[model samples]
Target chain A: MTTVFKKTPVLTDTVMHYCPGCGHGIVHRLVAEVIEELGIQDRTIGFVPVGCAVFGYKYFAVDCVEAAHGRAPAAATGCKRVNPNNVVFTYQGDGDLASIGAAEIVHAAHRGEKITTIFINNAIYGMTGGQMAPTTLVGQKTTTSPYGRDPEHCGKPLRVAEMIATIEGAAYVERVSVDSVPNIIKAKAAIKKAFQCQLDGKGFALVEVLSSCPTNWGKSPAEAMDWIKSDMIPYYPLGVKKDRTNE
Target chain B: MVSKVTIDENRCKGCGLCVRACPKKIMQLSKTKLNEKGYHPAEVIDQGACIACASCARTCPDAVITVEKE
Candidate 1:
């Protein structure tokens, strides 16, 4: 029998703080696995934003900084600018990037900052009691929107990957998910490519991972996966949004 | 050539999607009670007839299903 796979070395032995069935832990492991595979854990630095994954410092065995709410890109910008040789990346949620830190993300992408950004869009705000976020699906109920999101009043979910890819400075952009094992593997590869783009001085790179908030979605872990396949994928649409690698 | 499907009860949420997604009709969710997470997980009744089609594993959200050759 052939060995399927093994855990990544860059990940610490500490158990993740995320809730059971949360997708953050899966994405975290993928990032760590990529870092270990590329042999860059020693020089890697991660910036954690204010969200469910704010405790990223505890999981990754490397230098990590807790950025101000939604200001991770700004902090990562400074870190990569000052220490150009170090591997710098920002882990941000939809609430952080699409809401509070929108300006920071746009500016960073516009300036072509040499950094990688991992964007987790689970639709609802997992932290702070499952409120409707900027990326929340229309007709999706949250603490703020009980009758499901309304386009006439609250506006539609922002497609961050497509929006960010339009920027001239962004060298690579992709949207993936952890709904299945095959997709999870593909997502890891996309994330690794984003990091490699930054390493090559290719400019701003972003990987938007469509995650699941099972607790907030009022569904079991299994239902959340089905929801992702039926609802999230249709709106977000997986694939490479932009790639300037050939350029 | 009977393959048995085993589920890690601790991780299952008893969502019943796998039971709904199964094509072989070999699995049914346990209606007897709940697990540690208070969710009713699916249990295999006729394990001897499983063909290892992987439908349950594919539909499972928690990655808790394990298939073994008996």
Candidate 2:
């Protein structure tokens, strides 16, 4: 018999603390698999953000540093600068990346930091009980936006991938989703390419993943997946936003 | 073609994603048994019906399912 599917060894045996059906787990597995496939397990450094995945250090079986809220990019920049040869990446959620650490991320991309960032945009703050985030879609309701998001007051959702792609320093940028098996495969491929971009001494790379928050969104797992397809994908379309690798 | 599927009962969170992804309609969450985490783990009822597509494993967020083909 041949094994068709199994867990990658880059991830620790510790069970993830994410909610059932949370996209973090799927993305986490993809990152781990990429690190393993690249054979960079020993030199990889991951920055864990202060969100639902704050415990990310416990799952990834590699060097991990806990960064202040939304400051994962800043922390990763320091680590990559110091090590130079190490593979550095940051795993951040919507609140941590688009809201609080907005400046840090933009500056990192502006400076063309040699690092990769796995940005999970679930549209709501999962760790803090589903508060409306900067990436929260128009008319989407959250704890803070109890009556549905009012774009007149709250403003439209932020498109981080597109914004980063416009920057001159960013060498690679892509937006992908994990709503289905095919998309998951594509997400992994995008992640692999982002890491390869860094290995080839390219500038900054980021893959914005349109993830789901079933519990926070007040939807069943299946419904959450469907929502990503129906609502999220339209707003945050998946594909390569920018690529300077061949150049 | 024969395929075997094994779900880590202890690791499953009863999310039912595998059940939804299974094209053969053979996967189901346990109605009687519950895991240590108090969730009904997924199980394959008609193993013969499994096509070894591994879609269930791919969609599973918890990575609890393993698929093998003979």
Error in Å for residue A99 of model 1: 0.5
Candidate 2 accuracy as lDDT: 0.95
lDDT tens string, model 1, A108-168? 9999999999999999899899999999999999999999999999999999999999999
Candidate 2, residue A47: how far the Cα is off, in Å: 0.2
The candidates' DockQ values read: 0.15, 0.82
| Residue pairs in candidate 2 whose N, alpha carbon or C atoms collide under 3 angstroms | none
Please, what are the lDDT tens digits per residue for candidate 2 over residues A131-181? 999999999999999999999999999999999999999999999999988
What's the TM-score of chain A alone for every prediction? 0.98, 0.99
Docking category of candidate 1: incorrect
lDDT by residue for model 1 (B6-68), tens = 787766766565675567787887879688777677898887777776666644544567666
- For lDDT, the strongest prediction is 2
Identify the CAPRI category of the predicted complex in candidate 2.
high
